[model samples]
Target: MNRKVTIIASNGNLFDAYKVFNIAAAAGASDDEVAIFFTFDGLNLIHKDLHQHLPVPAGKKHDLERFKKANVPSIPEMLQMIQEMNVKLIACQMSMNVMNVKKEDLVDGVDVGGAATFLDFAENADVSLTF
Candidate 1:
């Protein structure tokens, strides 16, 4: 059976965005259908400039260093990998309007959509998660 996974990324934080893309990439690599929706603050993750520079919390400096030391891919790198893995990335149209984000502001290959579009995909999802 085809296992479908849906993830909603609602935060703009670096780690959260990384986690969402990482999970989607992993799932796609495993041959599962994977889709991610970036909503609210998470929309920033796909912004051309913003996606390149996600801030690390002051308290998490050591964690960032450790991740770097461990060779974890950067957020932008992970995003590229997700695309390479064929994971679907969606940007919420409603949130985009509220945030004044235009289609040109987002990375290439992201589908612009609304709740109904997400729901259509979610209807067949065997697993759904939000970060």
Candidate 2:
């Protein structure tokens, strides 16, 4: 059976990262092969340092207690878990250039490509989604 591929045209939103990685983790845990394609500011999610400690933003009175109570993994933890499960993380080449990100700036093992590379993979995927 063809495995699902989730392609996210991501912007650098901390909350959005949590949501997409949450889905990817659930799918990966289920033995469903998956990929997360990062573009736009989504590149921030793969940065070696930034992704680990994203602030929840201001004036929201964000509930850290709730987050702790729920045991939801942090972004870095989620990324690590998904990678351990063999979920593919692709960083867009163009986006990287636009954002002034060097490949070395990203965490290890992230694949780099344009749409042609990703779309080819998407063609055979059992499912596809974007964030």
Best candidate per TM-score, number? 1
What is the clash count for each candidate, in the order shown? 0, 0
Q: Can you write out model 2's per-residue Cα lDDT over 72-129, one digit (the tens) per residue?
A: 7778888999999999999999998888999999999999999887887788887787
lDDT string for model 1 (1-131, tens) is 45899999998988888789878877888888888999999998888889888877668877877888999888888889888878888999999999999999999999999999999999989999999
lDDT (C-alpha, whole model) for all candidates: 0.89, 0.83
RMSD of 2: 1.7
Model 2: lDDT to the true structure: 0.83
Q: What is the lDDT of residue 130 in candidate 2?
A: 77
Candidate 2, 55: how far from true, in Å?
A: 3.7
- What C-alpha lDDT, on a 0 to 100 scale, does residue 21 get in candidate 1? 80
Model 1: residue 84 alpha-carbon error in angstroms: 1.3
